[model samples]
Target: MKELSKRTAGFTDSVIRRMTRISNKYGAVNLSQGFPDFDPPKEILSRLAEVTKEDFHQYSITWGAQNFREALAAKQSHFMGRKIDPDSEIVVTCGSTEAMMAAMMSVTNPGDKVIVFSPFYENYGADTILSGAEPIYVPLIPPEFSFDTDALEAAFRQNPKAIILCNPSNPCGKVFTYDELKIIADLAEKYDTFVITDEVYEHIVYEPFKHVYFAGLPNMWERTISCSSLSKTYSVTGWRLGYVIAPPVIIDTVKKVHDFLTVGAAAPLQEAAVTGLNFGDDYYANLQKKYSEKRKLFLDGLDTLDIPHTVPQGAYYILLDISEFGYDSDLEFCEVLARDVGVGAVPGSSFFKEPENRYVRVHFAKKNETLNEALNRLADMRKKIAVKK
Candidate 1:
């Protein structure tokens, strides 16, 4: 028999999903994957119910349903401070997962290089590999999760075809400040590269920090491939609806790729999500408030246990430093934590380009009681580790 593709053999299972299985095996409170344990908004749910009987079962336009794209374009344009032609510049996808892949395949050729920040969303690495592009990783130094501009510029000097940016980043929750973004934008412009962004957490930011749309910057809209999902914002991850917004040229290419990929997202789901896209500002404000409360509840628990962590500025994750535990392998540490302490987390090494066993990523997208239970279990972790020491 012929051997499998080398690419397929080289990849391993996702750490986040693996931890989820471990959590299930141990009856642990699963915080490994970044999905909300709570329900989506009532309005979204109602809309879905209404669409169930509607005639949206058939495939809509290969790009997107007309009403859905129009609503999304208007909403996104209002926030992004740019005009968007839905027909010319949007391609609804299965999810941001598909959006990323489509964007990568659209712009990149085999053996091309792309810059990925270390400690990035795990999917970016796989996206690069699947696109047949080599990734050049630059570390986002720990605790602050900030990049060194010099290092970034050096990577850009390598003339990567693109850079994947995840603002309000997952697993660390650091929102890229405007100043930080400017440095990257400058580098992208100087290097003549595309910027593919994963902005699923655009509305989940904490107070005092704002989510910046990369395409909104000067000369960036042309070079920026904005990939985002309605999943995180509307808490309808199962719906698997996302889109890419870019200049006509890139969007045209991505639309062709997306059409061949999934032939557009589920029609009913896209139609239902239009309700969410047309929602008022109050809906977003309330979402921020809800996530902020969840963040505080979870972070306060971590503080009380004296676990060192990076306070998240946005998104639903916190990276906890566990170097003092003396374990050189984050996978082992996470397994022990799940089986012994009844909680699950992602090993930090999975997200980094360099060897790192001193951190673990925890998600705070749970109900108050669930988070309290996880915290209660974690309070005893120090005692158990101390005994081992």
Candidate 2:
């Protein structure tokens, strides 16, 4: 048999997912993955039931169903503080996964360089590899998880084809401030680069840390390929509904890449999720309120247990410091955590591109009871760990 392609030689199965499997084997509360353990909105569920019975069982347009795009455009325009053209700017995709992949394929040429933040979502590295582009890593220094302007500018000076921005970030849960976005926008303009954003957690931001759309920045629309999803926003990961909103010139290419990639997001799912896109600001406000409560409950539990953890400003994830646990390998630590402690976490090393082995990620997008259970398990951990040390 012929040898397989060399491009994927460095690839491994997702560490986050591997931890989930370990959680299953150990029967631990699985918090490794970022998915919610609850149902989507009631309105969306009702619409899904209707779509299931209706003629939407058939495929819609290859890009998206027209009404879905229009609804999405209207909703996004209202929030983004700009007019978005439904026909020219939108491409519904299989997920933010596919949306980001399509955006990479749409712009990156082989041998090009793309700037990526360290401790990024795992898929960004793989996306660059798949697109045959080199990744230039910039560190988001820990504690506050703030970026160095000089370091970022240095990466931009490398003349990268694009930069992947995951605002309301994963693992560390850092939301980029407007000043930070402005610096990046200025650098993108200076270097003539594209900005491929994964803003899936846009609506899940906590108080005092707002989410600002990269495309909405002054003079950025033409170069920003904004990728987002209804998955986190609506608690419907299985539906795989995501989209790219960009300038007509860039989106034209994205539409083609997305067309051949998955041929569009699910037809019935898209039709159903239109209900969520049409949700007013009050719905989003309540979403923040709900997630904020989860964050408080989980963090308060950790504090009571005297565990060290990063306080997240946005998104549903928390990074707990494990340096004092005396574990050298985050991978082994996570497995031990799952098997012995009865709580699952993704190794922080899996997300960080740097030599990081001192932390692990856990999420709280679960019901109150589930969060309580995970916290209970975690409280048991402190007892076992303190005795060992």
Candidate 3:
């Protein structure tokens, strides 16, 4: 028999998903994946129920349902401070996962280089591989999760075709400040490269920090591809609704790629999510408040356990430093954590470009009771591990 494609041969199972499986095997509180354990908004759920009764069952448009795109365009444009032509600039995707892939495939050619920040979303690496692009990783030094501008500029100097930016980043929860975004924008402009962004956590920011849309920067809208999902905002991850906001030229190319990829997102889901798109500002304010409360609850528990971690400013994830455990393998640590500690986390090494293995990421999107239970189990971690270690 012929061998499998070498392009996919090196790909391993997702560490986050693996931890979820381990969590299930041990009955652990699963915080490995980033999905919320709670239900979506009542409005969205009701809209979905209404959609099921309607005749919007067939595929709408290959790009998106007309109303859905218009609603999304208006909402995004209002926040992004830019005029967006729904007809020319939007392609609704199955999820941000598909949007990222579509964006990568649109701009990248085989053997082209793309700059990826270390401790990035794992999907960025897969996007590069699937697009046949080589990734050049620059470390975002921890604690602050800030990158050295010199290092970033140097990476761009290598003539990368694009850079994947995840603002309000996952795993580490770093919200890229305007200053940071400016440095990257300048580098992109100077290097003549595209910027593909994953801004899924745009509304999940904590106090004193604001989520900056990278494309909102001067001269950036033309070169930037904004990929985001309604999953987190509306708590409808299962709906798999996302979209790409880009300039007409890039959106034109991306729409063609998206057409051949999935044809279009699910029509019913898009039709239902249009309700969320037209939601008021109060919806977002309440979302921020709820997530901020969850963040506090989880972090307060972690503090009691004396677990050293980076305090998240935006995203609903925190990266705990476990270097003092005297182990250099985060994967092993995470496996033991799930199997023995009754909690699950993604190995931070999986998100890094370097060979570091001293951190693990946990999601705080679970219910208060769920997080409390996880914390209670974690309190016994040292006692439980002492006997075995």
lDDT of 3 at 1: 100
Per-residue alpha-carbon lDDT of model 2 for 1-389, expressed as tens digits?
99998899999999988988999999999999989889999999999888878898777999899999999999999988999999999999999999999999999999999999998999999999999999999999989999999999999999999999999898789999999999999999999999999899999888788999999899999899999989999999988998999989988999899988887678999889889889999999999999999999999999998989999988889999988878878898888899998999999999888899889999999999999999888887856554224
- Candidate 3, residues 1-389, lDDT tens digits: the string is 99888898878998888889999999899999888888888888899899999999998899999999999999999899998899999999999999999999999999999999988898899889999999999999878889999999999999999999998898788999999999999999999999999999999999899998998998899899999999888888888889999989899999999999999999999888888899989999999999999999999999999988889989899888887776657788888888889999999889887887878899899899999999999898877654223
Worst 10 residues of 2 by lDDT: 380-389
lDDT agreement with native, every candidate: 0.91, 0.92, 0.91
Q: Which regions of candidate 1 deviate over 4 angstroms?
A: 385-389
Q: Tell me the spans in candidate 3 whose CA falls farther than 4 Å from its real position.
A: 387-389
- For all predicted structures, in order, the TM-scores are 0.98, 0.98, 0.98
**Regions of candidate 2 where Cα sits further than 4 Å from its true position:** 385-389
- After superposition on all CA atoms, how large is the RMSD of candidate 2? 1.2
Clash count, one per candidate: 0, 0, 0
lDDT of 1 at 109: 99
Which candidate ranks first by lDDT, i.e. highest? 2
- On a 0 to 100 scale, what is the lDDT of residue 211 in model 3? 92
* Predicted structure 3, TM vs. truth: 0.98
